[model samples]
Target: MAGDNVDGVSTRESLKSALKEIVDRTASVELSGYRDSAEMSGIPESSSKLAAQETSGISGQSDKELKPSPLSGTEMASTTATSSKSKSKSSTATTQQSITSRVETPSDADVRLSSAISGLQDYFRKPCFVHSRLDDAVDVSSVITAMSPDNFSHLSHSSLVRTATGVRELAKRIGQATIKVNLRSILIVTKARDNSLIRLTRELARWLILTRKVNVYVDAKLRLSKRFDADHLLDPSDHELDSCLRFWTPELTSMMPDLFDLVLTLGGDGTVLYTSWLFQHIVPPILAFSLGSLGFLTNFPFQDYEKTLNRVFDDGINVNLRMRFTCTIYKDGHQTETFEVINEIVIDRGPSPWISMLELYGNGHLLTVVQADGLILSTPTGSTAYSLSAGGSLVHPEIPAISVTPICPHTLSFRPMLLPDSMLLKVCVPRGARNTAWASFDGRHRVELRSNDYVTVTASQYPFPTVTASTMDYIESVSRTLKWNVREQQKPFSEDSDGSTTPVNDDEGADDDQLDDDWDIDDSAFFSSSSSSTALSGFNSAPQSAVTTGSSSPLHRDFLTLDGK
Candidate 1:
């Protein structure tokens, strides 16, 4: 307990100091950078970017505002910023006049700077939980409107450069403890024709209904199951438990996301995929259990169902907003269909003997002419699916990039490449191609791309969120399921048992003496003179932003040491 307190304080102070520095530097830069630009542009781009990107999760637009919640300290602070910002917007008409009337002074800037600093300090000081209440989503950028270049009200000089999907991540980054979320309704997805799983599903459903007092929904077909009715005594006539239970179908596509707070999967990865298929648009957060064949996506264990659900409804989940690709097919320049795929999309000559003569276009410019059997466009989540078998590198989910692996290329020099998620990829079945090619979304919904037809693939705003036990579970799955790099112990030799000569390492070279001198060189002794103190101090100073991110903070160090996701 004592050690944890010290570590928590260190993490908090480190994060606070780092964030303050960024705020200080950003305020200075944006004030000087956008002073003149604001005059020409009416309002600074930095200030409007936040409003522009506040698209709701249900709208399939922006990633912000994934959920809605109660009136709490965090939300209150955000609300204050937004309301004041709104009032500031109404007075923008006089911005030019105010700017032209007088020049900004150091004192004025200092006042604005203090306002920004104090606002952040107050918000940061609040305890994470107050009676198990929380803001809908984790949003670090909510209270960032205090620093203004002025003459413009309710305007920020620039926006934060963070792409995080939840406010919990921001809180975690800033050294906050686990907080709770409001979960009222849950929908459980189960595999078909599996009696054991159906029984497990019923068990979970009843618990959620009686113990949790939350509305529970199950597979639409289960309403007809005599076993299901007999278990709850709803088969004969009306019952009180029947009121708590509901049946879910794909027809609830438009309104299901808004009604259901969370989704639970009982079978396995396929059950998870079926959930994805059920909701092609805005998807609710999915918490999966490992009951299927391969448990890659199903990271949670069924044994811990009771504990996991309690924790989930009590303390919120740190959702990984996994990116999905929006693949839209266009024929003769007219949009025909659009489907989102969590895994990679394959475009190859289907059931034909001809090589797929496809042309690749990146962001509307011709990048290459594909002469391979097919091209694999995979998200990092799906990198291990079809991408790995097709020789694509295993990419981490955090990396904002896509895998482009050419499947069975005819050219000897063709190799797999990774493209940025921002790149708009268009693969066309050339009008003069010998035959039509096919495309599939997550190994389902096969669509034929005829001659002169092309499909545009880009990162979708709607990301699939799955509840994970911990980030390490992903790496552990690689070892446990895939058995990555598994091998038998190699033979060991002992000098006493077998007469042998010592072998030198292959890395050693003839110029070992020079390397030794370099390694043994002294720094403080060499820079002992007063004239070299500046250089010494400069050399000793390390950057705050490191490869692990926020290196100056103890929180980041702890994160790295724990192998955090």
Candidate 2:
């Protein structure tokens, strides 16, 4: 009966029955597509083919020579491992977290290195594309070596090695390493009310990190809450108040001395001054990146963070060692306290209705009784800052001088004077003064000075080091940053030309001749007049009757008359 049924079925019906059976058999196969294996292996089929093509391209290279492409996550990790292995080859490399190989012969190596670096410099001089990757290619060793030792010393060995490696690696990867420097840390400090400046500082920090991968640290307590929530921050929680407390916890507080290499200060000159005051005792170098409206102390531009930072790391820029003032406050003839200032130590009226009385003395000699709103005692470096506003002369940073400027003096006769750096200045508020004065160090940390309180100020033993580009000079920085008489055209006298010297006026020469002639005439007339007077006196004194007799003789009479007159 089964055989008859099979024979009765048409060929198409038989084919359909077989296809249905096949479809039923593949139900498990369709279920397998939904299984974990298919879902878990999420890579597209096209990607495998693309990877295969890439591998095939480098198939001819030896296994050792053919590095895995860093684009792939696994391959990148593998490459990093390989790099770590390469770094471990040297004993000196073990201490260093990053890979750095020292040249066996630095003197000989520098020649070849300098040539390569010079080529890179020429390449960077032109307009070029700027990306994070491009910045890694610039070789700044030549520029570093060419800079002054004082400037170059500011850059650590690690920084120099990293910069050189980044430059060289970039050049090898691409055609050139684009120069994009960054100021890594910017500290913005303002009063509790300065929200606008705080916002600007945050914006600057965001721009730097996004465009240049620079790190920014804000030290202002008022903006700490907002900065902790900033979106661009990688580890917002890391900078939380709790984290900061944890960092300075009992265990780590002792180690705080060794934690930070440098500190960066943002905001105005006041912020920099405040930061310097806080760290002066610790004595770490500061990189002050200005974010304020007026930046006399801050030489760095907010926009050129990348270039500035790169110059710091790569070329070993110079640092101006700014002098600081150390003040010792005395109360009732006892040493009460000591403070340091980067700018000026200002003694002013503290909420008093009347002007403060300040008796100033320089090296034990009484300078003057300064009756004014305040007095500014500043280092040469601070001359352009608060002192300048107080009618002080702008002294160069390199000059060893101190500026004593009176602020809003009651008398017009009071003018600023530059004193020798070696002198110790004593400022006192005498007994029964109309109003008491207050002393502040760098616009921070104020101390009240009652009647009979004395404040003594002198140059500090230590100096603050400030890093700058290799091409940066103190005078040039003042001119460019401060916009102090930056004239484009040179005066004729200033021009470098081989020309005839200006002639002296004939009147001047005649005056000199007349002076000589007058001296000679005076000397001759003096001797002649003395001799004639003696002779006439003797002739007239011979006798009153002799004088009347000499009147008949012209020579004797004239001589007698000249002697009498």
Candidate 3:
């Protein structure tokens, strides 16, 4: 690897030297043209031969053919002087006549001087591609001379008549070209709870701005109050923060995802989830640095941030297109509000004594009706989140599927099911339900769903493109996080000096799937898109079995429950 790097550096140095040589040659030719033209202009008109010879030497072109010479200044001057002195009187007369016919309206010296100036202007205006070999190298003047204006005629079809509009369009293209080299913007989101994470964010931001000239955007509140605040309070520095960096608060963060080229999240999986939620519509790619426990989504570590960012900047990494769901609440007919979900949307019995009843409709067809603690409609990207705890399947983020899992469903037959992303889901609260069901989108946008109110779930048009670390992918993340297929250390068969093996414990590793009992506190609150009742008449129809509430006894259900019998 060291040898390869050395070779690469050597090749780059060679290329740089070759390019510098080409540029120096071009500059010299331009400077030489100015000097020769100035010298020729001062000479008397009688010395037309000297003027012609000097002009030829500077322009690097012969009079007969406009073919530029690659000879050095001294060589060109010697060659021109020798040719001029060696020519016979008859040859000189023929040359002067040939020059006269070419410049019929003007003298040979004036025409040649004008041509030389025009050649310099053309060389300066055009772009040049330098060859690696010095022998095959051609200067700017030669390239422009060999190139025919007619060859680029197609570039300005409307300029055939030289119209005012064409001139304006050409000016616009030139202005665009001048501004086309844009510097990319990067947004940094760090975990505020940890001082180390905040410090890392500041260092990363400073490095990006100072080294890459990239614009960095951070939460203004965090920058003002947290790390920045602590820096001033504790160990003060002589240097101030970069003035070029833009600070944005939570209110302004809504505009950030679109303005920035990429997002760098330094924290745990929750930080990435939060960033994903911030971009409710279009989400730029994210580079997540893991600095917290259980970093399923935060693939890269803070220690490897430099290498990880290098890969991202060089576009040497791939992005996983994680699916998100666009959920809307229809109160009557019109949509109340719409929000996006990177994780599961939980519709649960919030602070209610009775279980929440929900009727699920898939693509206008009744899929199921269940009385449960809640219902979770999760995108494949969210399968490993709360949905997993609710007994939902772990789906790969790349899969175009959605999981519907019921939280403590009363019916034993109600199992989590995966459906195609194209399927539209409508979860409605039936009339005379025990209580209003509350819905939350990715643990936010909590709204109360009364009788006849429904919320629709569909795949969002925009997918979140997340960058992963070299260490883990989706499958590895699941294995690492959930400890999937992990087994306990089993004791091999052993005889206690009796030629008999002790009874093996069949219950060993039985609790491998058991999850931590730590209850997740519901601190976040949000609502999905909601509409009015009149707009929801289309979904009022439900399956007969779904509409009926079975009796308390598992076997003795009332068939005529709709009649309240």
How accurate locally, in lDDT, is each candidate?
0.64, 0.55, 0.62
Model 1 TM-score, all chains together:
0.58
Of the two candidates 1 and 3, the one with more favorable lDDT, higher being better, is 1
Error of 1 at 427 (Å): 0.7
RMSD of candidate 1 to true structure, Å: 26.2
**Worst 10-residue lDDT window, candidate 3:** 126-135
* Residue 533, candidate 2: C-alpha displacement in angstroms: 40
Clashing pairs in 1: 138-166, 138-167, 138-168, 139-167
| Residues 186-209, model 2: lDDT tens digits | 333342346656565555555545
In model 2, where do residues sit more than 4 Å from their true spots?
Answer: 1-258, 350-356, 410-413, 470-483, 486-565
Off by over 4 Å in 1: 1-179, 230-241, 491-565
Q: What are the per-residue Cα lDDT tens digits for candidate 3 across 1-565?
A: 0011121122222222222322233333232211212222232332333334444443454433221232333433444445665774556666565544444344443345444434333332221111111112234345445345765556565554455565456434422221111225677887766777667777887778766776677665554455555334212342343434665444334422334557888888788888877776666667788787887787777887777676566654455667788889889767899887889889998999999888999999988787999999998878888898999998877667989999999888989999999899999999978899999988877899989999999888666767655424877877887898999786675443535344344574857439553324321111113454543542366445544555644223543553466
Candidate 3 runs further than 4 Å off = 1-183, 229-243, 470-472, 488-565
List the candidate numbers ranked by TM-score, top first.
1, 3, 2
lDDT of 1: 0.64
